[model samples]
Target: MPDENFYLDNDDIRFNLTHMVDLESIAELKEDVGSPDCAYESADEVVETYLDLLEDPIGVLAAQRIAPRAADVDKEGCHYDNGTVTLPEPARLNVQDLAEADLMGMTLPTRYGGLNFPATLYTAATEMISRGDASLMNLFGLQGIAETINLFASDELKDKYLPGFCTGEHSGAMVLTEPDAGSDLTAVQTRAAYEEDHDHFHLTGTKRFITNGCGEVLLVLARSEDPEKYGGGRGLSLFLVEKDETVTVRRIEEKLGIHGSPTCEIYFNNSEGYLIGQRGRGLTRYVNWLMNAARLGVAAQAVGISEAAFAEARAYAQQREQFGQPLDRFPAVQEMLVRMRIDIEASRALMYATAETVDMEMLLSEKLERLDRKDPRYADLRARRDRFAKAAEVLTPLAKYYTSEKSISVTTDAVQVHGGNGYMKEYAVERLYRDARITSIYEGTSQIQIDRAIPRVMAGAFEALLDEYADRDYGTVALNGLREALAEARRSLQAAVAYVNDQKLADDQRDTDYRNLTARMVCDMALDTYLSYVFLEQARHSERKAAVAAKFIQDMAPRVEMNRQYVMSGDRSVLQQFDLLTGAQS
Candidate 1:
């Protein structure tokens, strides 16, 4: 029997898709391209057909197949025997069900056996799958690896790997991390050298902390340039290696959460492989693209976990009694529940917006490529493409940083709402809390996201977005106060950016020195302002969202102001007193 409580039935996702997303534009783009499998005549038809045919089935799978087995899968985890990794029986069965349903390749082109859905719909599906079992997302989300191959690999390579991916006969792993190179990927020591006699490259090195490393296809980043001749990231190149005897699974890490998702340590000993894209551009071009997509996937995963956590808390609070009344009747419990709900909605709004932008960027790029360079329409299309591309650069990191961090906080609070019961293994909140911890750590850390976002905030990328939001008028009089609050938050963000710029000019190295210290402050301000606007826009069509917007702005605007003040204070005491503060390193 299907769990009637599937998170996909949540009203907010449906509202966002129907009202907030630009489905008309997406439909027109798809129709213009004469989509092979999906040929809806109108935007409404596309949305209706997608929900009925694709999204609904995915939701059913999550409720019936995935969610029911998640706990058992966690207990069993994955097995390591000799050099092979075997998934828990429940996990293995879940994968088979998803593959048999043709749900593995949601975003790739139809010609490659994918559904060819836009990123927004794909994100929606990912959220549902993650909510069912966060560990399963590790396998389902790896479809990005296949998408990368479709985008950058040769036609020969595409024909070789994509069909297997769609058929569930193959899975993939991104093999990049080494013992010495975790966050600093440029330090990777893996070697991939061409063998003249064999006419194929041979990969040799150890890759640690690899997710799904035992999968059929592996994307490995290796040093193609000799270190003595070329150093740093310029020496790096991407390669595609299939599972063979030459590639060995050394061991799988016993992790705190997501136990069903094996994190393997792999040894590639002269593994036969083929190169991807141009040499010397792997890290800068290909891997960066892969990382951005992965980050968005993490953001969706975070949202999914939050949804599950919130549901558990809300249901428990409503049923569990204290002093002869439901716990939800208590004011303290009410506050926690409301805050968790608000955070979940805010995070979803931001995530879907980011996904929509990414979809536009991808669709426009494809359209631009198809047009003649000398065509007059090409210039306009190029401008739209670049705009969305830049938006994606800032929004992707923001979505990842904010949503992942919020998931952890929300899950912690969910446990708190459950009190002693949440600490027990019997409660789902306990597992969710553990699972939420890694979302902010991998793909890129919260600190890394702040560092990337600081320069974009400083350069006025967010300023235009803020202005656009401010200029839009909400039809309801009730939302005017929320609009004003959003305006104030935007102003506060601008002040923080101005202060950071002034500090940067005061010292030649201040940008490098002080940026990291103050980056989080700026990012918080940006997130609050951005989400406030997102919710406000959502309010135009939804009364429930109007209340969500009101509560979020009323609660969060003050914090944004406080963060701005902290940035403006220009306190350098931490940097100045580092030695004293640290007590001589021991």
Candidate 2:
């Protein structure tokens, strides 16, 4: 029998999917687009059938196959031999199972043989897959490479590559990072020289820390222009290169975690390439789009890992005995378990909300592309598209930042719950802890996400969201205290935002120095309030959700106040004593 406690049995996920999100509208959109394979009469039927078809098989596979092999996969890891990268037996089998199930290219168009599900459904699947094996997500999440191709590649290129991706005959990698160009793409030095006679570009450079770099398809960012003449990002272009004799996996990194995923240092020695989209717009346009999707994928991974960690902690707390009672009977252990569970739910709430916004943005954008400007509804469609786009811009980074940080914290507590056992490889929490460490570092660091999210908060992008939450009745007397706490958190967020805005207007130097610190405080304040409201909303349907909401708000309110006070304090000691702190010569 399959484990009954797999992802499909997650009450939080089920509630969010069935009750929290607007599945009816999404179903309507999917049906209107034409359900090529399945027929359904109503929106409810469409949603129910879609969820059943996607989630059931995934849950069984995760429980019966992936979870059981995850530890061994991590142990065996990936191997490099004679320029060929090999996945461990378990990892290889995992991929084969998913491929045979036709689970890849989920969000691509049906014409490309994809399921064409919305981003919300796809994100949910990603979360489940990550829960099963965080390492495997590194491979499964590369579907973004196919989505990028579908979005930007010419028809000929799409025809050549996308079908194979849908059929699971090809996997892809986003080859962006170089030795010196980790975060700053402007420093990318890989060269792509166009050959007029051959009608193809030849790529020559080294890319470092590329996940799945050994995959069949690679989207590489290379400097197509002379660096001496056009320096920085302007010289960069996006190119699609397939595995060939010219491309070599020189070495793979021995990482701290997710060992099953190969991080390759690849050498491109005059590899054949096809340009994607326009020249010089790789970083400014295509890569930015790809990064957003990747960041969201990372957020989902974080949430899934957190859920897994929490489950391990909770189960252990219930089973482990101390002084003739379960460890869960002890107050300290109980506190840790409760906090872990709350954090997992809160992270999921934030992720699903962001995913819903992403779905709105994507579907609306696609609709606008086919819309005629002269049509009566074009203006409305355009307006909605832009609105959702802005919301996604703010929420995606916010989700990524909050969930990644929460995953680290939750996993730490999970380890703490296991005591010495968690430190040993005998338990899964040790591996989970290591896997959680990389979430905030990759797909844009937590610091980078804060910088991206701050402007959105200051510009009033989330003001309407606060108002909407404030107006909801929540339909319960017990949730009133939680509502008040949420309101207080929002006020604290606004105060922090006000302080940062004032500093920006007061002194340019001070603003530049303290912007990151200020943004961090405000972003935390916003997340606490947003998640509290989500929990309060969820409370209407489940008493368990109400308990979680109450605990979260009670714990979060004081932190929000502390951040608010720190932001308003105008303490510039870090800036004032920078040289002293660093022992620099003046």
Candidate 3:
């Protein structure tokens, strides 16, 4: 029998698609996009068709084709043997399988041999692949890199690169990070100077800690102007650098995790590169656009890692006997298991909600573009596109921050459940434990995410978005309760903001301590409130989900309140009682 329970619920994704954001009308509007009379099937029909595919053999192929090789790939790792850094047999073949199945170009338009699937469906595929092996997700998820090129690449560039990417003939890498330029990509030292005769730029400098650095195609961010002309982010530009004699792989890093995907230290010596988009706007325009997409990919990777960790811990608890019966019988073990489930479910709910917003935005924009070029009669499509784009802007960072942080927590608990066994390489949790650590660290770290989110939260973008969801006439009683809970949570968050602003502490820039403390409180309350709404929405869609949703809401609501209280209490003990808490000489 097929393991249906291992995958996520389709109804939950659909609920997010329909209620979490307004997708039905957008789907209808974008339906007859390319083909006349090709009306979009119902949202439920779309969800069912996608689910049936997920339940099919293709789903198992990921676990069979990729998951089994995860350990060996991690052990053997990618190597810089000879001039070519070669991937292990399993890693190379897995990419080939995804390509052959037309999954590589999933969200791209069919004109480019892609499936033209919505971003929501692409996220579903991403979650499946991630569940099987978190390491492999890095390679498989490079479709976003290809997406950047497709969206911004010149016609010649797209024709040459995108086809290979879609067919798995080439792999893509985002070459941004360097030894000194970690978080501050504007400090990038890589130089790209244009040649008047050739009209192509020549790149020179070494880029370190690049994911898929050995990929066939590289999107590099380099300074095109005089090195000293740029202060922070100015005078930088995006470049399309291909694998060539001049671009050499100097070395590969043996990283803490994600061993299957090669991380390289690449040296560019007069490598011919084509300028992408415009000059002096690489950091601001191109890289910003690419990072937004990449952040969402990280969120999906987190969900995948969490699922893998949850499965191992859940199975271990059921099978591992302690004392007289299964370890699951123990109250402590049961509590751990429940917490694991709750966290994983909450993370996934947040991730899916984010994906829905992304999909709507992407599809709407595409629809409006097509209308502008080919069908000006459809003006409403343009308006819908703008609305979704705004929503996606606010939701993406929140989802990435929540999911990545949750992955760390879920994987940590997974190790705890395994006890001594988790420490050993014999169990998958050991590898998962390591892999889960990177999600929060990379793709604009959790701190960066909060920095991005603060403005949106303070500006009340999410508050307005939630108002739309609140207006819906939900059919389930449990869902209604969740809405009420979210409403209450929101009220608490608003109160925290008011209290902080009113207090003198909020204005003290010197004391970043208070701001950091308040940011966490506001984010947590908002996250819980958002999650409460998501779970309740799930319950509304299916009776089976009612208990799961209700259980989560009941447990999470109090934590939401507690987090709020922690912030609202105005406890400056960290400052006033700092010396008492940790003296210089104990």
What is the per-residue lDDT of model 3 for residues 1-586, given as tens digits with 9 covering 90 to 100? Answer: 2344324433443445445545444444335433655644565554455555555534665666777778888887887875588887788888877877877887676678876566666676777788777878898788888888888879899888888888888888999988899888879888888899999999999998888898899999998988666666898899999999998888898888888888888999999999888888899988888888888888888888888898889899899997879888999988888877777777777777677667767766766666555576567766766766777777788888888888888899899999999999999999988998899988788887887786667666667666766666568564775667767777887787666655564554444467666776677777777777667766765776677777877887798889878888888887777778888435
Better of 1 and 3 by TM-score: 1
**For candidate 1, what is the total of clashing residue pairs?**
0
Best of the two (1, 2) by TM-score: 1
Question: Candidate 1 — which pairs collide?
Answer: none
**How should the candidates be ordered by lDDT, best one leading?**
1, 2, 3
Q: Whole-model lDDT, candidate 3?
A: 0.78
Estimate TM-scores for all models: 0.97, 0.95, 0.90
Let me know the TM-score candidate 3 reaches against the reference structure. 0.90
Q: Using TM-score as the measure, name the better of candidate 2 and candidate 3.
A: 2
- For model 1, residues 313-403, the per-residue Cα lDDT tens digits are 9999999999999999999999999999999998898898888889889888888877899999999999988888888889999999999
Model 3 superposed RMSD (Cα): 3.4
Question: In lDDT terms, how accurate is model 1?
Answer: 0.87
> Lowest lDDT 10-mer window, candidate 2?
504-513
Q: Write the per-residue lDDT of candidate 2 for residues 507-542, one digit (tens) a residue.
A: 455475566667888888888887788888888888
